[model samples]
Target: MTASPPDNSAQMASPSYRLAVFDQDFLLSDSLRGVRFLLEFAKADLALKAWGVRSTVVVFGSARVRENGDPDHARWYAAAREFAALASQRGGAFLEGGPVRDNVIATGGGPGIMEAANRGAADVGAPSVGFNITLPHEQEPNAYSTPELTFRFHYFAMRKMHLAMRANALVVFPGGFGTLDELFEILTLRQTSKSPEIPVVLFDEGYWRGIINFDEMARRGMIAQKDLDLFGFAETADGVWQELVRRGLKPHEDLESLTKSP
Candidate 1:
C-alpha cells in the first residue's frame, strides 16, 4: 500500500503551537498575572530612568474639580496649577540636559486637579509626569503633561508603586474617595516605615478637616499623636511649598549645593 502524505495542518493550527510572547490570550490569563505586573512596573520605570527623573513631587486631588466650577473647585484647581508650576521651576525639573532630575511634578494624569498641576508644569516649560490608569469610566490623560512621560497602567497597585517610589514629597489638593485612598496609602507607608520619609502636605486645611476627623482619630486612640503630624495643611500654592519645606522637602538648589560640597 502506498504511504499517504503526512498530515501537519492540525498541529500547526493548535493554540499550543503559538509563541508565548505573541499569544495575547495566554499572556492575559490569570497564570501570567505576575508577568503583567512586572511589565507594568518596568515600562514606567525605564521611561522615568531614561528621562533622568531621580525624584518627583507627587500631586494628588479630586478629578472632579473644574477651573470654572463652584468657588471651592475653582480655587482648588487654581492652587494646584500654581503649585505645580512653582515646584517644577524650583525643583530642578527645568534643568536642561541634566543627568539627574529632582522633584519633577507628577500627577494622577486625569482632569481637575491633575490637569491643573500638569498645566502648571507646562506653563513653566518643564517636563511633568502623568501616571494615568485604566478605569471603567475611562480616565483620559490631560494635554498638559509631557507626552514622553505620560504613562497608562492597567493595575492600580503598579500605578501606585510608580507614584510612591520616586516621590520626594506629596502635595494633596481637595478630593474625594480616590484622593483619600492615595493620601492614606502614603501615610500608611510612612507610618510603617515601608518607604523613605517624605514631606506630605494637604491643600485647604478646612476641606480636609471637614472630610476626615484625623484629630478625633488620634484622640480616640485609632492613631498615635505623632501620626497626626505626618501631614500638615496649606491654603495656597505658596503655602503648600512652604509647608513642604518646613516639613523637610528640600529644594533642588540645596540638593545641588550639597552634592558639590567637600
Candidate 2:
C-alpha cells in the first residue's frame, strides 16, 4: 500500500481534540444527547441527596394563579401557600438536621402557585426545592426556593422524574395542561405500580370536578371505579393535611397540634 499522505489529524483538530469532555461544542452534539440526559438526572439527584432531601411533598398547579387580583386566584394561591407551610412543619422536613428528611416542599419552580408554595416554606424558615424547567416562555425559578436546592433542567422527563422519585405526597391546585400532565403522570405510576402509593390531594373539589369528570369516566367504563380512591378532594390547606394523615402520613413529633398559626 502506498504510504499514507502526511497525517494532519493534529492540525485539523479543534479545541475538541483535548479534554473533549470539557468541550461545549462536542457535548452539545446529537451523539451526546443521551449523555446530557443522564447528566441532568445525575446533577439533580446528587444535589438533592447531598442536601438531605429524602422525600418531598410535590405541589403542582397553575402558573397563572395569583396571590391576589381575582377570586379563583386568591383562593388557590392561599391554599397552596398554607399547604406547603403545613407540610414543611409536620412532614419531617424540619424534624432533624441530617441526611434524610421527609416532606420538603417541591414545586415546578415558576410563578403563581409554585411561588406561593415555595414562599410558604420560606415563611416557616424551611428549605424548599424548585425543579425549574427551561421553557420558551413564562418559566423561571421563583425567588422563594432555597438557592442551592433549586435546579434547572432542559428536559421535562428528567424534571418530572426528580419530582416523582422522592415524593411522599402530592397536592394539586387548579391548573391547566401542565398541572394535569404532572398529576396524571404520578397517578399512572401509582396505578401501574411503577411507584409506591402516593397520597394525592386535589385542592378545590369543584374546580377539578368541572375540569375532569372522573365519575363520568368511571361510569362509562373507561377507568375502574376503584380508581376514584386514588385521590381525594379538599378545599382548605388543613383538609389536605388531614387527608394525608388519614392516608398513613406520619407527622414529625413536633407537630402535635395541627392548628394553623395566625
Candidate 3:
C-alpha cells in the first residue's frame, strides 16, 4: 500500500476558525487583549445594569484589617461594617423591589475592611457588590457580598473602572499602597472634573492626617487650598454617614418623604 499524502489543507486552515470566545488560550493572546478588555467592561456593566444598581457607595481599605483581635483592627473593621449598614439603610439601597437601587455598598471583595463593609450591607438585607481582582496570591471574594453581584476581573484597570463608574460616594479606611492608589485615582478625577462630584470621606482623621499632610500640600502649592475641601475625615461610622448626607447624597426614600411633606 502507498503512503497517504500529508493533509496540507488542514494544516493551512486559519487558526481563527478554531478560536472560540470562551477559549482561554485565544482570549489571553496578545492580539485579543483589546477584546478581552471590552469583554471585562461589558460583562460587569451588563450584570450591574441587570441588578438595577443605579449608584454605589464605594469602600476602600486595608485587606489586613480584622474584626476581632487588635484594638485598631477591630475598630476599623467595626466602623466599616457599621458604615455599610448605615449607607444601605439610608442611602436608598433598601428600595421596595425597584429597578433603581442606589448607594449600594461596593467593596474590593477581599477580607478585612472589604469583608466588613459587605457584611454590613448583608446584615441589613441589602444587595451589595464586590469587584474582586485576580491577584498572584489568590485573593478570594468575601462571603458577605451578594453572590450574584460579585465579579472577578483580571485587569486592575477594568476593576477600578467598575468601582468608580457608578459611585455616589467613596469612603476610604486606613490602608497602604492599593488603598492610596484607588483614593488618588478618584481624587484626581474629581480634581479635574473628569467625573461628577462625589463626596470622598477618609475614615480615622488621625490616621489620614498622619499619612498625608494635606495642609502642607496646600502650603507648598502642590495643591490648591480649595483642594483640601475635596475630602473630609470621619472618626466614626455615623460620622461618615452624616458627612455623606451633608455633602448632598439624598436617599431615594428621602425623596418620597420630601415630596409628601407639605
Candidate 4:
C-alpha cells in the first residue's frame, strides 16, 4: 500500500483541468453566452475584413418562395436572382484588386430568395456573402454563396449586426414574418439614425402594400409622413438598382472618381 502511488487520474480528468478555450462544455455553458456572442461577432468580422468587404447590399426575402413554385413565387425568385446579378456586376463586388469591395450582395443564406440572390452573384462570377442562422429547424446555407464568404451564426442579434454594419443599401423582396422582421429592423435603425443612411428598396410594391398599409400607418400618425420616405418601391431587378442609385447609393466607379477628384 505504501508503494502504491496516489491515483491522480480523476483529478487530471476533471473539467477544471481542461484548458478554458478547449473546454467545449464550459464554453457552451449559460455563463459563457456573452463570450459566444463575441466569438460569433469576431469570427465574421475578421473574415469580412480579410475579404475586403467594405460595404454590402443586404437582400431580405421569403425562404418559402421557390423558382419552380407557383406563379408569384417563380416571379419573385427570378427577380431576386436578376437583381443580385445586376448589382454584383455594377456594384463594387466585381472590382478586383481594390483596397475595398463595396455594394457586395448579402443574403440571409437560405433557400428561395436568399438562394436566388446568391445564385445571381454566382452567375456573374462574383463573390457574395451568406449570413446563415441556426434555427430550431436548422436552416441550411444556399449553394451559390461564395464558399469562403458563407457564415453561420447561432445568435440572431449577432447575425443582424453583421448584416447592418457595412450595408450600403437594403433590398427587400416579398416574404412573410421573418422578412418583415428584417425589413423593420433596418428601417428602425435608419429612423433612429443608429446606422448610416443606406438606400432601402422594396421589390413588388403591390405585394408590400397588400401585406401592410404603410399609408394607413402614416395617416394614423403612428409613423410620420416623412418616415414614409425611408424606403421606396421597385417593380423589377433593374428598377431596384435605379431606385438604390436614386436614393444615394454610390457605385464603385463613382466612388473611385470622387476619390481621384480634386
Candidate 5:
C-alpha cells in the first residue's frame, strides 16, 4: 500500500477513524487523518509549488552501477561526474539561457549512480536532494542532501509522485529493472498525457544501446518512430546542454490546474 494514501481525504471529520501511515517519526511529525494532515501535505505541494522549488533535474540510475578502474567503467563514472557538475553549475551549460543557476540535483537517495550524482553535486559545494525509498533493502539516505530537501517514502508510487511533483526534466543514467520500470512509468504517463509534459534525457548511449533493443521493437511495429521521440540521449554534459536548450527549458513545475474551491 502506498504510504498515506488520501483514503481519509473525505472522512477527515471523524477523529476516531484516524489511521497512522508512518512510523512514529513520520506519523508524529507529519500527522495523519483529518483535514489538518491533508492540508499540511497539500501545502507542502503548493509551497515548493514548482515555481518556488529549486530548479531541479531528476537523476536516475542503478544502485548497482559501479565505477571500477577499468577503462570503460572509469570513463563512464568520470563522464557521469562531469555531467552532474555541469548541471549543478550556477548559470552553467544546463542553465545557460535560464534564470536558474544552482540547479539542485535530485536522486533516489541510495547508492550507485544516485549517490554518484549527489556526490558530484556536493563536490561543487552544493548539496543535492534525495527522495529516498523505504524498501526492504532500506535504501539509505545519502549524505549529500540539503537538510530541508531530504525525504523518505514508504511507498514507491508516493516517492515517484514526489519525484515528478517538482522535476523539470529527467536524466536517466545506466540502471537495471528498477530504472527501466521508472523510465517506462514516466513515459507511459507522458504518452497518455496523464502527467505534465517534461523532457527525459537518457544518459550513457553505450549502456542504453547495450541494454534495451528499442530498434527491434520499432521494426516489429511494436512501437512507433514518433513514440521514440519521447526521449533523447546525452553522453556528455555538453550534449545534455544542447538538448536542454533545444527543448526550451520549462520551469521545474507543479500542479496549478486543480480547480480551487470557491
Candidate 6:
C-alpha cells in the first residue's frame, strides 16, 4: 500500500501534498510513511511488553466523559472503573482456563471511559495498550497509556487490526461516534463472519438501553434472534467476569481456525 498523510480528516488542504503516488505495479517509496508505521508498530509492541500482558480485553469508550457525569444515579467513572477491573478478571480467567495470559488491558488509547479502564488496569498491576487514531479533535491518546503502548495512526483500519489481533474479549463503555465506530466494526466482523466469536460485553445496561434499542430491532425482526445473541451486557465488575467465564472466552488466535478469518 502507498503512504497516506496523517489526519486526512480534511480534503486537499495542501495542493503540494499528494496522498499516494502509485507508479504502475510498483508503489513509490514514502520514506516518512514506512518510518512512522514502523515506529508506531514498534511503540505498540513495546507497550504490550511493558505491561507483561499475555492477552488483552479491548475496551471502547468516549474520551470526554467526566469522572462526575450523570443522567442517572451512578457516575460514569464508577462504571468505567468496573469495566477495567472486570475485563482484567475475565482476562485472568481466560488465562488460567488453558488460555495464554494475553490478559492485559487494551483501549482506543484516548480519554473518557477509555482512560478510566486503562487507569484501573494499571492500578491492578496489569499493563494497558492504546491504539489511538490520528483524529482532529478529542482523539488524543490518554495519559494512562503505557509510554510505549501509545500509537497515533493514519489508518483506523490498522489501529483496529491491532485491537482485534490479540483481543480475547471486548468491553464497550458508553461513548459517541468514535466508540460506535469501533463497536459496530467488531459486531459486523462477527455478523459477517469476519471476526472470532469472542464475547462482546457492553457496560452500563441502562445507558446502553437509552442509546440504542437492540431489543426493539429484534422485535421488529430486523435482526434474527441468533444475531441478537451475539453480545451480552453486564452491570457489575464481578458479573462481567462471570458472563465471560460462563461463555468460555479464549484468545482469538486459539479460536482462529474455528472462527471467521479476515
Evaluated with TM-score, which candidate comes out highest?
A: 4
Q: What is the TM-score of each candidate against the true structure?
A: 0.95, 0.90, 0.91, 0.96, 0.71, 0.72
Number of the predicted model whose lDDT against the real structure is largest: 4
Pick by TM-score: 1 or 3, better one? 1
Error of 2 at 223 (Å): 0.4
Ranking by lDDT: 4, 1, 3, 2, 6, 5
lDDT of each model, Cα atoms only? Answer: 0.93, 0.88, 0.92, 0.94, 0.67, 0.71
Candidate 3 residue lDDT tens string, 23-49: 677878899989989999999899988
Query: RMSD (Cα, Å) of candidate 2?
Result: 5.9
Please list the residue runs of candidate 6 whose C-alpha ends up more than 4 Å from where it truly belongs after superposition. 1-54, 71-74, 93-100, 250-262
Q: Which of candidates 2 and 5 reaches a greater TM-score?
A: 2
Span of ten consecutive residues with least summed lDDT in model 6: 20-29
Taking all chains together, the TM-score of candidate 3 against the true structure is 0.91
RMSD of each: 1.9, 5.9, 3.4, 1.7, 10.8, 10.5
Candidate 6 positional error at 202, Å: 1.1
Which residues of candidate 1, in runs, are more than 4 Å off?
Answer: 1-5, 258-262
Candidate 6 vs. truth: CA RMSD? 10.5
Better of 1 and 4 by lDDT: 4
- Better candidate by lDDT, 1 or 2: 1
Q: Model 6: per-residue lDDT, tens digit, 1-262? A: 9778677646555534444443322232464556556666666666665545556778887777877666432366666766676656545623344323555688888777778878887766655777788776646777777766677777676788789877778888778898899888888888888877878888777878899999898889987778887888887766766666566676334443444556
Model 2 regions more than 4 Å off? 1-15, 95-97, 252-262
TM-score winner between candidates 1 and 6: 1
Decide which is better by lDDT, 1 or 5.
1
TM-score order of candidates, top first: 4, 1, 3, 2, 6, 5
Error of 4 at 119 (Å): 0.2
- Output candidate 1 Cα RMSD: 1.9
